[model samples]
Target chain A: MSALAEILFGGLFQGSLYAMMAVGLALVWTTIGVFNFSHGVFMMLGAYIAWQLVELGLPAAVAFPIAVVVMAGVGWILQASVVRPLIGRPNIVLVVVITTLAAGSLIENGALTIWGPRSKQIPALIDGNTTIGGVGVSLHQIAIIVITPLILAALWMFLNRTRLGLALRAVAQNEDASHLVGLNVTALYGLAFAIAASLAGLAGIFMGGYRFMSPVMGSDPLLKALIVVVFGGISSISGPIFAAYLIGFFEAACSYYFGLYWTPALLFGVLILTLMVRPEGIFASRSRGLA
Target chain B: MNPILTVEGITAGYGRVTVLHDISLEAGRFGNVGLFGPNGHGKTTLLRAISGLLQAKSGRIQFDGQDISGLSARAIVGTGLIHVPQGNRLFPDLSIADCMALGAYSPRARPHEAENREKVVKLFPKLAERWRQRVRTLSGGERQMVSIGTALMSHPRLLILDEPTLGLAPKIKDELCASVMDISRGGVPLIVVEQDIEFLLELTQQLYLVNHGAVATEIKPGESLDHGEIMSMYFGH
Candidate 1:
């Protein structure tokens, strides 16, 4: 494959994964009215679970759904137990900090207990190289690229067209009014968290198959997702996706020309620039910050 | 005529500070009442308390004779007590049509969404004209219409409008008053909270003069309460 094609294909595949990963974080942030720091841990848990299941002789297809479902269940339970009790409280920062501390400790210790410190490779769902338009791409990478978009399309439909989707959107837009109209706001919060966790779970499995899984592998993806959310603007569904692809392509180009080590610097620079130019993210039209 | 909605001794407040103290009122079948008070005296808070947006420290709210005191905002709204809250709380990102659809968000109202939407559109032709337009892009008056139209979609037996004319022009306020009169005539009881005495007197037959969250006085239409009494009651001498 030509260098340019490699960059394009690599960027696209990675961007899709990044977008999916960050979407979960974004949903939790917007819907639950909390900056949950434990979101990345959920992703890690998914990867770890998928790795274990694959080790037990389960097929990749079965293992993936199982991981997502587990993570979603965890998400629901967490919201019910920890997040729900703190609703209407003014201590948002405390909740966020606690989530972060709890998540980091849990992930690091949980990984040590279950999967050990050693990194594990996931057998690729599809192997070998595939060529498209004179560009060579790995079949595994192509599968991820294809799957991510399809998942996103389904999510878009779920949020926009379904009954719960409308109610969820209403709750996100105006919490008090949604309650006034008789929506179960607490239930909506749980669903939002579950959806987010499921996305992270999906990302974890995808990452495990494409690369390698470790106890602390979630940090990079979580940070990248945060960047994508910031770049796309908070609360915008399409914004993060577009920004994800852009960042992915940018990272690939930087890695190719300047070496892989320079990618982080480039991403941080882009993030800083975005913050300077548009604090609300490139997609936010009006100020949505709570007064 | 049977009372469709009743508020009995509802002592409500924010947190520990009491705003409304032992206040009570009612809306009869096909009735319209004006709740008048000065700023910060619990006019809006009463509406909030009754609509289940704010929990009363002690009280009973009977909507269709069912106790709604401890009910969730959703349940209160489900019992045909819809509150068009202060400020035009339109879902700015959603279109006018979507906002209207969300009005009937309860399970019972969900099935008749299409029919209710048709009636709402007919009532507010301006909304029909801008059905697809996002609510955030709408003018103040247009957004108010969308807000009211959304409440109407729920097919509420009692509509609680809190300061609907807060920031509108005189002509727009007049138009809004006319809309309220129309809604009242259409058989939905209205409890309109307004500072404009003329606006209230022109449309409503009964008045609850709220002072410090308590019903200080009740005035019936055709009563010879002069403007002096109204001014003192509104301004709180």
Candidate 2:
């Protein structure tokens, strides 16, 4: 019983981080219609930025927001330079592939240029441990779990209630229609990309404190985010958040009962099954509304 | 009356395939001009050219006595030329309010977003009723209303509607046509493209009959031909 509780707690906490990481990739894909490969690199870049701030003796709270801002700026620059020119071009597959390759190259080269191939661990923001139903849990881990859902709720409100959010949703649905409605589509695209990068930066910040930072740290979150986005539905924001929780819990259970190797296998197995059964995704059925 | 829009020797195409050849039309504020032709006759293409969705290979377009041939689609939209594109092109996954809000996407429309939104909901009261409802859930006619209302948000000087009544029931078509008339009456120059000459003949003053990417004739409907003759002319013998 204690073991189950421990596993569930751990999984849910890890999944929250996954949700943050995936949000950016899903956003870029939905709004801009580009599966930005550079999404993971953005995460890496964010983590590094936060880590550097810490090295500069800045507090974690200040560093985190600054990292997000920097990442957003980076995202804007990337979209302006690389993504804008390719808009309305029919070759979406090539664009996606190019972005993915570009991201990977950034990661490999960036690590060498900046961090010098060394893995760095961040000092946990919330140190010490707590017990949940007689199961030991770190305060930092619990904070991560609580914070993920909080961010999700905030994001939900932001998208539904804000003018900018509504515009982004419109662009995601139909770029041409958004344009006809007098939307500055280019600006909207830049804004969406920025939001995505900010999310990635936040995720990276958490990743650093939770474990360690390195160029290779990006792949784990990226893969997890990919799964969450697919599981949630490419078009739905709420779907990804829910999918993250589910995947997180599942991963926790599998890792506890089986082993580390069985975790990926089980996740992949479930992902495959879900893909075969509901390719549009689990949340997609309920979200059949307009763009 | 001063011409609100003037197209002189405008030629346009997608890729190497030319769709409009020397196609030109002129209109004044409150004027409703109908482009009557069969499918593939370049009516939509001409509107697209005017809207800057497609560039004119060789031509000049003057809107309100200013050359606007070099503007991008976004820029042209900013100049009060709102295009309600063919096919119920609403963002299917978005809500009614969001769909209507998109009409205020240009800089000129931003300041009047609140006023325009109120006007849009008032015009299509169905949209106001289902303001929170997703666009995909609306009936085809409701979606059409939203589309028209969306275009109107820009306070358009010139409104170009492509196949406004396409795939609609006869009753719905009548309602849409009435709305178009109402919009034109409100001091916006309207260019309507329709396959049905009878509909245009009833709704508009001047008609341009297009054939093989060129204007076959520019005439008044009630004068030179009856409804049957106009149909035969557009559809051919």
**TM-score top scorer:** 1
Interface RMSD of each: 2.0, 1.9
Write candidate 2's Cα lDDT for B1-237 as tens digits: 677888898999998899988887786533578888878878888888888777899999998887889787788888898889999867887777776666776778889889878767666677788888877889898988888888888778888888989999998888778777777676777888887677777767788888999989788534656877777777688
- Per-residue C-alpha lDDT of model 2 across residues A105-157, encoded as one tens digit per residue: 77658766878778887667688998998898788887878887888778778
What is the TM-score of each predicted model, taking all chains together?
Answer: 0.94, 0.94
Task: Estimate, for each residue in B1-237, the C-alpha lDDT of model 1 and write its tens digit.
Answer: 778788999998877799999999887643688888778888988888888788998889888879899888888888888999889966778888778778888877778788888877777788888889988889899889988988988888788898889899999888888888888888888888988888888767788888888989988766737778899877778
lDDT, candidate 2, at B67:
89
Every candidate's TM-score, chain A alone:
0.93, 0.94
Which one wins on DockQ? 1
Docking quality (DockQ) for each candidate: 0.63, 0.62
Poorest 10 consecutive residues of model 1 chain A by lDDT? A282-291
Give the CA lDDT, 0 to 100, for residue A111 in model 1: 82
In angstroms, give how far residue A190 of model 2 lies from its true place.
2.0
What lDDT is reached at residue B207 by model 1? 88
